[model samples]
Target: MVMATTASTAAPTSLSSVTLEVADIEAARRFYTAFGVDTHIHLRASGTQSTGFRGFTLALTVAGPATVDSFVGAAVDAGATVLKPAAKSLWGYSGVVRAPDGTIWKIATSAKKDTGPATREIGEVVLLLGVEDVKATKQVYTDRGLTVAKSFGGKYTEFAAGQSSPVKLALYKRRALAKDLGVPVDGTGSHRIVLGGTADAFTDQDGFVWEAAASPAPTPS
Candidate 1:
């Protein structure tokens, strides 16, 4: 994976990994693996709380309609429910699917598909989140020291992309999110996603969970 340099001159925290809580770890793993994402599973302890989604979507960008159809087909074969079938849109040929774990995925390709596979083929893995307020949510991350790549429409926004992990971050209005998913806008409950690569465990203003993946190096030990 090509690393995305931080837009910040110095970031207080950098993400190491992403975690999603699924009803069946192995099942979720198989789905993502077939979809070309390798996820490590952690069986929640007996006393640990379970997880649910406020709203989330993992997006993938491919070279042409062929790659888009191929990968989306693979995801469908793996038991994912197709929310939006592959087709041309204002953006390009795009489709949406929801995994058994309730994570929504959108696979899309550009209209002008001359870009090499090296520049294409699932280069973008964006995490589109549902939040109470778009501008407020954007501020939460920016205040934490991240940079905004692009944002508009008051209902949607995204962090600057080209990061170490292709999983770019984005936000949307909660009501808009529910409308997009054809579900109710409910932000109460476990986020189902875990942010890794930090020294402390903290929840975002929106209540998403994050855990430390590694400790910093010892000085002159």
Candidate 2:
């Protein structure tokens, strides 16, 4: 396992924070807080919000469109790959992007027609992948069979295969990704297979760790 020694000199700008909706907000909060991120608990008269200093905001909400578009665009501008351009669907306007750690982000606009605060909602599900080479990883997904939905330099790339369910995947450079996500890179490599999903982690010759996940049907809007 390689310890991340390089710190990102670039301070975050534009993206105020990203919120991840979880089945258990408290569990998510505990996991991330233990990962070295500064956390804040905001309790409103109406509800509560947990914000993480790792440049993301976490909460639970029904998903919506305008929120999806705004969130996806901001992530893309901030070096994330915009997989599927935001568009209207039977469900809503959907978009996909890759986070710094090779996690797939599925963003969808709401299907309901309303102008209220709850009209549009945003959420993200992460997919993990394993790869031998970051450069080759990008190529395998972009070269021939797959389609390049979007690319952010060599750091990240997104591909779409026209699946009925949301399919946005990202390739991450192992060492760099570990530093960004504040996780210790395990040299031995690991593979996790869930009933309907699969994830594996391995290092390339350059010792870059990688993870890939196959998610269930996109979360209900």
lDDT of each: 0.64, 0.38
Extract clashing residue pairs from model 1.
4-162, 4-163, 4-164, 149-160
Kindly list the per-residue Cα lDDT of model 2 for residues 122-221, writing each as its tens digit. Answer: 2432233333355665553333234566667766665553443232344555555444434444434222111121223333333333323233333321
For model 1, where is the 10-residue window of minimal lDDT?
A: 39-48
TM-score of every prediction relative to native: 0.76, 0.34
- In candidate 2, which residue ranges exceed 4 Å CA deviation? 1-120, 123-132, 161-163, 193-221
C-alpha positional error of residue 27 in candidate 1 after TM-score superposition, expressed in Å: 2.0
Stretches of model 1 off by over 4 angstroms after superposition: 1-14, 39-53, 112-120, 161-163, 182-188, 197-199, 215-221
- Give each model's clash number: 4, 16
